[model samples]
Target: MKEIIQINLDNEMDLILAHKRCMKIAEMCGMPSSFQTRFSTAVSEVARCAIAKGKNSLLVLGINIIKSTQKEIVAIITDSEDLKSCNPEAFNYAAKISGHIQYNYFDNQFTTTISQQVLSPGLLTETKIKGFIDYFKYEPPLSPYDEIRKKNIELIALSEKLTESENKYKQLANTIPILICVINERNNVLLVNESLENYLEKPLLTFERKTLTHFIHSADIDNVLEGLKRAKQNRSDYIGETRIKKGTNYIWHLVSITPNKAEDGTFNSWLVYFVDINAQKMIVETLKDNTELKMIQLELESANSQLRFKNKELQQFAYIASHDLQEPLRKIMIMLSRAGADLTEDQKKKFYFDRITLAAGRLSNLITDVLNYSRIENSEQYFEEVDLNKVIEEVLGDLSLIIEEKSAVIKVDQLPKVSGLDIQFRQLFYNLINNALKFNSGNPAVTIGYGDIPNDPNFTGSAEKYDVISVEDNGIGMDSSYSGRIFDMFQRLHERDQYGGNGIGLALCRRIIENHNGLINFSSKPGVGTTFWIYLPKNKRS
Candidate 1:
């Protein structure tokens, strides 16, 4: 449902009544006070033009729906003749206030449509507003100039009211907290409030002749000027952030410029507002410094964690070396002591000498494993782009004799180039392949393949994706219970009579993978195959 109000604009009083009626309906429609003034003023201007051209006019007020959930007041002024009078200033001021104005001359009728959104706090009480609405509907129309004498008197009163408004505006400007100033098109200060003086720590008169950019930081002068240029060219407001000079010190502020028009409704000057944002800027700086400090703390914690891990590893190595290294030597000594001159040649050859040789070989292997395990940490420091396929091919070549003797099948897929130590990679592949061949049931066969880490069951982390390289062998695998235990130093599941190993090869692989920030995990079942999955980060040093 919509409401309509009509008023004849034949006299000054009649026109004024039309304006008041339009405003009441616009207010009933919940229009803001500012827009009510604009809409009614635009209605008066259009109705006045029709009367000035010696024509009859009627003003129509109705509630209009602009879009879904949006309603506005629509003011229509229709004239009996196509009036020649047009006031651009009135149209512009109306446009500035309501943001809408339409005029058309057709069918020997000149019509103007002025509209404004009716957004306010409350709905009109129909009973309370009915008297005002009836004023436009029931009043008898008057001559267009019947109240000319009274209009002359009101004009004189309006001149005095204008002077009082200027004083009130100045008083309002002085009371605001932010720095407010008005600058002319020439960029010279036309007026500034008392807040401006407090910001500069000087009297307002001192800034009168200087250009507005004089107080801005040199580095920020261009930005302020650019904002000014854009606001002027576009005839709108613009906001900018910059530092302003407060004597020898600089403080940041949000500078906003709004075009201020003169009485003739042309863009006369810019009303500038400087809102001090120094406290916000200081808070940001403090947060940045705190973030940097937090990052350093995180790095220190990571380094300490690595150091703790290495210390625990060293403790385990000491235990293994102290206990295991002396076993072979003690056995050798015992064999020699028991055979002192009482040993026959056959006994010496079969028992004492052979036992001594076997003990020596075990001792040698133990020492070599210990050295290799320790060297994994210290041997590599710098990294280069390494082709793993080439390294795997080279490892196969090194073990050619063993491969041929065992009649093993070696299948390798194309591998990727990774950022790592090539020597360590070769050692890693060589140890895995050699172990697979040695532990096979009869003939050895190993397959090496690579893929993304997300497909591997061992990866359980966020999407910081990694690459997976798997080495699988169809050899005699151990029980699942020993899957994690096989990587420990000297942790052999099989006796020396069955399998010959110091049990440090897998341990070395674990250290190398740890140094590269990777994971080494294996899945196995007794008498089935075992696959070792190595997960490495795609593009990181640690």
Candidate 2:
């Protein structure tokens, strides 16, 4: 069904327009004069009944396809009011005239449809229907009375809206607790609410000759005026805290000023509100005068900071230990069970024993890593002259099994010695190399080398010339957008089931680098690879 025209049956004038529109549409559909009169009469009768018995009655005329080929002119009348018990005489009359009428009631609303078969369905083509729509939209009324009636309806609607707006403004100004003042664009006060008059202890008429800044304290008057000036120039709202004069004393109040724009996009006036903040001000003053209270607050803040740091360290330790230990423990249990079953085969028993040893070794390494992570978190470890080359070697040895399983390649250049915690550096490379091996789709090729630091604007390190080491990989890379938050705790780009281990590897690397007064960053592209750049300060410190 395609609706061409709709009319709100608000008054007798609308009913006449509905009937005329129905008849004209019927004629346009190639109906004979007799059928057009009958269809129009039936639609008008139903519309009249709906208007009399219902609220917000609407009539729509459209073309509906029947049985895929036949076309008929349909008129639907809907209203918000329930008509279950209303008289059905009009519906019956419409059905007799049009031969098809449907009345439906749902959700306390009713709709009545009246359809008339087109005389020549082929004549009512798409072009013809569009022509009908354009005619009803742009064509002049058949009589002068209709044009006058439409103008009158528009005037009535505008008047009602203006009345409603005035009533709302009055209700809000008189009832709200906050003080309100209306000022013109010239900053001259035009109106003051009763609350404002009471706060000033003066009559409302006295404000007519005063400026908007009259009630503000001298110390805050300039700021309030500047804010209002900017707001007026930009046609935006202004909010600031200022001291307002109440009786004989000045009290702090949050002032908000909003510009009122007219229909032509010009500012006419401004509405200013003052809300009391005296209680909040008193509390702030009391706090400022108490030295013991300030000391207690500082101590409490420091304690909270330490507590949060410890809690985070414990959480990471618990999660990483539990997550990494599961794999090794499962392997050890499976190897023991297999060895128990195949005690007669010496070769199989040796393989099971080797697997158990490897699992135990991995479990021990994980425990040491977790412990080192806690020490690094607490800044308990002292820095020494650390050999990066040896650290890389140890990390490679720790990840030897995964590297061999994945047929991975590791390329290394001469890494410079730096003053840092050895255990932390080992854990950093362990995580980076292990990730390179684990997240690869095929054989992983990782290159660990040092280079001159790139002049990146986003780098925030304080080093003039630092040791810049890069760990590049040929693995499944992530989106570059995740680079910002890639080092956040527990932030994983891939699902755990797809990739193993908890999402704390990169976070730990970042924490260790920060502890050494350095920065760690990465660049990645999906399907290409990722390269992590580490910037370490050259200066030595305790």
Candidate 3:
């Protein structure tokens, strides 16, 4: 007659679930074999009657007794529906019957009560008691109720195994390196692991009163809000990334979320885990910055190149003007000479007419040399495939008169074919030959020769494509002191009158060779002859 169970349920499903809960609870508590089924069934039947007939309320408050001697255990439930809805006479009758049953059992008594107010929307009142039927110890009662109770004991043992499995799962979660947390529908954290406190740098209790927003960075608030809304609304997993602001720095994290639902399939809270990914974020940002820097550098280089080109164009324009002006000056010098020559003996203007004519001729030659130098200086012309030997022969033909006049003993050798501008190459050879013929000490004995030094170790260039072209002479050799400036513009070691020409010839030769991307250099001794060497790169057809 002890108070075992009571319920006041509005829905039949709730009553059923409650009944199952009671049976499971009985199984979990290790109820004795003699009373296991009787206890669970008695509680189920009482709860069913209360919920169906009484107002809607069900409450199983607490367990009060466990008695091995009588094989009896008791729980108390407070229900108020019976007092208001049941007939007073029938209730009194049932109470009397239960009292008689308790007295026949033992000296102890148990009672579970039902009041009218318990059915109302308030707290349920509960009472529990235990009675033992231990007097007939020699032969225990063996009823169908006792057999059902034994099965309940077995079921309880199995449930203990399930609880052990649950503990194992919790242990597994604890072993993970990541932080884990469970939150409720109200956004309140329900459970947090030790790993969560590791990163938080605070105690677990500190997060108890705070919502998820309290730990998140302000800039990421909007994104977090959206993800939270989606998780709760759809009751599905949502994932995203955000940075957690440390003091002055920030730690980036990748968050994964999983949603759980309530018994009624309503929205629940998310199961969240945050993973640190700050290193990867920093690498991506660094690469982006470097790329931007390279682009800026390239743009600056392009601008510098454009400026240099413009400057070159201006210089070329000045050179062209100077070159064109020389023709008129040459003409004026010739006219001045002619007018001087026409002066009469009495005029006194012809006192030095020979000297004047010579001076005018020199001036005219200077103008012609200046114009040629300017034209070559401003030119950006390129070279093509041409035979150097042919260019040399043509230059010799042009200087045939000078060769005959000097009675020069000129000796020539075979030359190689090279990629070069025909006119420039001819000028280059012509200048060198002129210098040799002009500077002869005795009767001209100039020898122009061409030969390659097989794999010349002294030559430092791409061996596969570079070759040296030597123009050697056996004329009056120059002093070592003047050899260095031999290719300088208007730089004459000997006087202009002595050399019978301006000193721009060798300088123009240097320019023409350099324009072909070749080197022009010479070696000389005071008494020995000189040799001018041109090292050029071979052009590939491709």
TM-score of every prediction relative to native: 0.38, 0.37, 0.39
Candidate 3 per-residue lDDT over residues 1-542, each given as its tens digit: 33443333555554565555455445434554333444445444555555556554455423432222232234443454443234444444434433311112122322343211111111121211221122211223244544454466569889999999988988887778777888765466777777776667665343113456657787675577678878777777878987764445668888887886668976556688878888997787677877797997898678657857986897787667766766676776677667766677665354665666577677767776776766664335555688887888888899889899988877777777887678778878888888888787766777666655442333445545655677666777888677667888878787766778777888888777656656666777666677787777677311
Which regions in candidate 2 have their CA more than 4 angstroms from the true location?
A: 1-375, 455-457, 460-463
In model 3, state the lDDT of residue 177.
79
lDDT (Cα, tens digit) per residue for candidate 2, span 16-128: 89989988998888888999999999988888777778788988899996754689999988888754246578777777888888888877668888899886787678888
Task: Please name the candidate that would achieve the greatest TM-score relative to the true structure.
Answer: 3
* Cand. 3 TM to true fold: 0.39
Clashes of 2: 0
Tell me how far the alpha carbon of residue 4 in candidate 3 is from the true structure, in angstroms, after superposition: 99
Q: For candidate 1, which ten residues in a row score worst on lDDT?
A: 120-129
Error of 1 at 275 (Å): 41
Question: Which 10 consecutive positions of candidate 2 have the poorest summed lDDT?
Answer: 204-213
lDDT tens readout by residue for model 1, 354-395: 667677777767876786677676322687789998999899
**TM match of model 1 to true structure:** 0.38
**Which portions of model 1 miss their true places by more than 4 Å?**
1-345, 349-351, 378-380, 453-456, 462-464
